[model samples]
Target chain A: MSKDAFRARLEGTAAAIESLLDRLLSSSPMPGEIARPPRVLDAMRYAMLGGGKRLRPHLVVETARLFGREDEGVLRAAAAVECVHGYSLVHDDLPAMDDDELRRGKPTVHRAFDVATAILAGDGLLTLAFDMLADTPTDPDPAVRIALVLALSRASGLGGMVGGQMLDLEAEGRFAADGKPIAGSEEDTLRLQAMKTGAILAASVDMGAIIGRAEDSQRNALAAYGRALGQAFQVADDLLDAEGEADLVGKATGKDAARGKATLVSLYGVDGARSRLRRLVDEARDSLTAFGPAGDALARTAVFVAERQS
Target chain B: MSKDAFRARLEGTAAAIESLLDRLLSSSPMPGEIARPPRVLDAMRYAMLGGGKRLRPHLVVETARLFGREDEGVLRAAAAVECVHGYSLVHDDLPAMDDDELRRGKPTVHRAFDVATAILAGDGLLTLAFDMLADTPTDPDPAVRIALVLALSRASGLGGMVGGQMLDLEAEGRFAADGKPIAGSEEDTLRLQAMKTGAILAASVDMGAIIGRAEDSQRNALAAYGRALGQAFQVADDLLDAEGEADLVGKATGKDAARGKATLVSLYGVDGARSRLRRLVDEARDSLTAFGPAGDALARTAVFVAERQS
Candidate 1:
């Protein structure tokens, strides 16, 4: 696929997700807006509706399409997953965490709004994500909705994203004295990255498969594809941070090295990380062999993940 | 319904919920600990165990008992609601929010641990609450589990608790110029209080009703009871903050007045708030009239909510 075609596909996904989010989180007098406070909705919109690649939602859509099931339910599930992703970004940019002032080429939620509002907005978005999954509109079968909730909570909770965050913070030497690095091997760094970003990204595909009601074999294949894609995405992200310019990356660059945080690129040189990324992308594309021509879009997605500037 | 009998029942309920929470949040490999990490589990345990009246869980169990269903499922649902409540308190006490130094006669999570850990702990607990609701052990019927997830998310999300916190922070003049009190009516104050504490408390009963598969009329009646009990509990809490000693309350007192925060008790004086509290208790007891002797435990709970010192 050409760069222009991939960009068009990404923008279409982003537009769909942004509209769905606005419908769900808007403070206007919709069916559920009877009790929604305006200021909180404003803050939530700020965190959710603006701009990003919407890569997680794209994975959800494309994976569900693999099973030949595309409906409003899939779209809502995609939006739900994006909500969780957006909330994590909001919380991660807080002053006590990464302390980032900019995200996606704009002020972070905490910088645009007050700290308290930003915190509440993140909390609201996270809770709403689960709410969306359990909502009747998410799927006709209640069991599928329940399964989505269960899988997503596991992906985002103690053993996954949040727990990984705690490890990442500790690795940043915030708990250590005199900037002494914490002890961990190369495998540990990869595991940390997998847990923090890879889990949720992979879960997006898993959720799509669950909603589409794919067979176990197909589900396993998609899971493998998602895991490999997640690895490629995160490693590419680290490489961008390690080497990309601030203008292209849309946030501070080289801060990972400055903080002495552990990353795949940090443990291996940039060339080594780049090589691993290429191999992961190849693995991701190879996992969809069963789907043949239907998997071409996903294969293109892998290429986009590997080469994107931001 | 003697005081001694009620005390014994309350203690029994607390012990049961505490044990369940320990099992759920523990790092030990007792079934669901496949991917649980240790440090985040420690923070979650600290946030959840060893504090509060366990009023919410008690509400859940007793309400379910009123419908003649008492089992592990109810207990797990009870523990799940408590996790949501506990996580809210943890996040509410963060430095950017309440900035409190102590809670339940001990240091707050941020005070006990660091701010980043506290934030992650709160995030983990919230996710786990949804996870528990969707876990098969929580209910035999997947639809019931989905219903529980749906109801709990609505209670915890933007239209409910988190949005209320945003309003409460705004009422504290956190967003006002020079800390000037915002304009509002008495009804607005009560509505704010209802959204903050009342929603979750009522949600506990709603969850119980859903789990037990109550009749429509019974569910509505129990919902009314829960709402009234919530109001009574909050008014009593405000009165305690207004009049009780700090040591007796197990945390700070008179902070509401000091911060110029609006509350039912602050809007109306002590005597007025007490009268309202009595009326809400009567309303609650009256709502349970159809259940007759089966609701005796819940009736007694209303009395306790009205009269408890802490």
Candidate 2:
């Protein structure tokens, strides 16, 4: 697949995700709900729609397509992952967390809404993610729906994304006895990054496999692909922060180093980090050997992760 | 059933929930997880265990027992409800929310840990609630597990508890156009209380029915009981906050009025609120007509809600 074809596929999936999210976050309440407060609903819609690369959902769609499964259930699952991703961003941008004022070129949820509304919006999104997965529209099979919920909760829960965020805060010396920043070893950085960022990204691909009902070997292969791709994506993001222009990145840049955030880029020089990015991208593509030409788009995505300007 | 018997049963279920939560929030990482950061794990455990009445879990246990589910799975489901309740309290006590320094006779999670840790702790507990439900131990049948997840998420998500919190904030005039507190109508208070405090309480009973595989009529009856019981519980809670001593209630009293919180008590005055509480408790028990002797414990619980000193 050419770069343009991959970009078009990615953009198509992003648009679909946006539409699904809009419908999910609509003002009307679903069955079993009392009422949807308009203000919080608006904040949730603001946090989710019209933002980000939608990379996780793109991975879900592409990987499911790899296994010859493409349907509404796939889109629902993709939207669910995006909800978790969006919720994490909202919470991470709160006054207590990263305190980011701008996200995807718009004010962060807390900046757009109040702190309390932002908190509830993030909570709503996180809870709704599981709700969407467990709904029959996500999958006809109860087992499969339960599987998706289990996978998602594990990826986003204590030992995964949330834990990763806590570790990141601790590394910033938020909990240190002397109140000074703590520097982590390279191994610690790798583990933290995998939990914080890699777990959810990998789960997005694994969820597609679950929806596709892939064979164990196929699932494992795709998971390997996802792991490498996740790592490469993070290293690429760190690189963007280190070298890319703030206007192009759509958020403040170079703040990571200033906050003493432990990143692979800080441990490795730009040249070394770039080489590692290349190696991971190769590994990502190599794991797609089972899919042959069908894996071309995913292979290109790995390249996109490595070479994208933002 | 005697008051002592009901108290013993409640304590037994609470102990069981505490034990289950301890195991679930243990430091050892579960499958598919990289590592559970110690600080976050501690914060999660701190937030969940060693506090509160465990009223939600007691509701689950009794309601499940009212049918025929009396096993480990029932305990697991109950624990999941408690986790959601715990997470809500943790978030509600945040500096940006109610900013309460203490809860249940101890410092709030945000006070014990930093705001960032408290936020992540709440996030972790909330995610784990779904995880515990989705796990096979919660129910051997995947369909039952999915039902539990769907019901719990709806109760706690956008149009439920989270949405209720948002409405509560709005009612406090947090978003008032003229920068003044908004005085909500009686209807608004009723809806807000139902969503904020009543949804999850009702879910506790409804979840028990789901676990017990109650017939549609039986489930509906239990739901009615839950709805009335939840309203009664909240009214009693407000009464306690209005009149009980801080030492006995385990937190500051009368803060609701100070914050201009929209509660039934505010709309009805002390005597009227008490009368309404009695009426709700009667309604709760009236909904249990089908169970007769089997629902004796639940009937007693309603009286407890209305009459308990703390």
Candidate 3:
């Protein structure tokens, strides 16, 4: 697959995800709900609907497609992944967390709304993700739906994304008596990054496999591909923060270094990080080799992750 | 059943839930997880264990018991409910939300830990609730597991408890330009209370019904009982807040009136609120009438809600 073809597919998937999210976050109450609480609903919409690379959802959709499963259920699962991703971002940008004011070129949810609303919105989104997965529309098989929920909760819960965020905060010396940032070892950085960013990214692909009912070997292969792709994506993000212009990156740049945040880029020089990115991309592509032509889009995606400017 | 019997049963259930939560939130990581950061795990433990009436979990266990579910799975489901309840309290006590310095005669999570740790702990707990529900141990049947997940997410998400919290904030005029607390109408207060407190309480019974595989009519009766029980619980809580001593209640009292918070107690005066509580308790007991002797404990619980001094 050519770069242009991959970009078009990515963009198309993002658009579809945006539409689905809009419908999901509508002001009307869902069944079993009393009222939508418009302010929180609006904040949730602001946090989720308008923008994102939609890379996670795209991975979900494309990986499912790779396994010869194409259906609306796939899109629903994809949207569910985006909800978890979006909720994490919203909470992460709070004053108590990263304190990021801008995300994807728009004000962070806490900045756009009050802290209380932002917190509630994040909670709502996180809960809704599981709700969506358990719904029959996501998959006809109850076992499959339960599997998706279990995978997502494990990926996003204590020892995964949330734990990763906690580790990141600790590395920033938020809990230290001295209140000074402390850099971690290279191995520690790897573990932290994997937990914080890589887990959810890997789960996105893993979910696709579950939805598509992939064989154990196929699932393992996709999981390997996803892990490498996730690391590559993070390295590329760090590289963008280190080198890309703020305008192009769509958020503040060099803040990672300013915060003395532990990153692979900080341990490895820009040149070394770039080389690692290349290798991870190669590994990601290699994992999908067993799938042959069906894996082309994913292989292209690995490249796109490594080569993304923002 | 005598009051002593009910109290002993409640304490036994609470102890069981505490043990389950301790095991679930252990420092060791679960499968697929990379690592459990000690600080966050500690925070999660601090937020969850050694607390409260465990009223929600007791409701779950007893309701299931009412339908003859006596296995360990009932306790696991009950523990999951407590996780959600714990997560909500942790978040609600944040400086940005209720700014509660204490709970159950001890420091709140945010007071004991920093705001960031508290937030992450809450997130971790919330995510784990679904993980627990979807686990095979919760139910041998995937459909039952999915049903529990769907019911929980709806009860706790946008239109339910989280939405209720948002409405409560709005009623306090948190979003108003003038920054003045505004009292809501009686109807608005009812809606808000139902969503915020009643929904989860109702869900506890609904989950019991789901786990016990209750007949549709039995489920409906239990749901009605749960809803009324939930309202009675909140009204009793408000009365405690309005009139109980801080020492006996195990936390500060009269803060709601101080903050000009809307409550049925605030809308109807103490005498009126007491009358309302009695009527709700009656309604709750009435809903459980079809269950005959199995409903006796639940009926007593309603009276307990209305009459408890603390």
DockQ of each: 0.65, 0.91, 0.92
* Docking quality class, candidate 1: medium
Models sorted by lDDT, best on top: 3, 2, 1
Chain B TM-score, candidates in order: 0.97, 0.98, 0.98
How accurate locally is residue B77 in candidate 1, as Cα lDDT from 0 to 100? 95
Q: How do the residues B1-310 of candidate 3 rate in per-residue lDDT, one tens digit apiece?
A: 9999999988999898888899999988999888999988999999888867788888888899987897788888888888898999999999999888988889999899889999999999999999999999888999999999988899999999999999988888787888677868999999999999999999999999999999999999999999999999999999999999998998889988988888888899999999999899999999998999889888988898788877
Candidate 3 lDDT for residue A259: 84
Off by over 4 Å in 1: A1-6, A29-34, B28-34
Local accuracy of candidate 1 as per-residue lDDT tens digits, B228-271: 99999999999999998999898899998888777777778899
Scored against the true structure, residue B299 in model 3 reaches a CA lDDT of 91
Strongest candidate by DockQ: 3
TM-score of 2: 0.98
TM-score for each predicted model, relative to the true structure: 0.97, 0.98, 0.99
- Per-residue CA lDDT of model 1 for A1-310, tens digit only, reads 5668767877888898888888887665333322788887898998888778899999988888888877778889999999998889889899988899999889999999978888888899899999999988889899999989987888898888887787788787777777565766797787777778988988998998999898999999998999999999999999998989999899999988887777888788899999999999999999999989888878899989999898
Summarize candidate 2's per-residue lDDT along A53-115 as a digit string, tens digits. Answer: 899999999989987888889999999999999899999999889889888788999999889
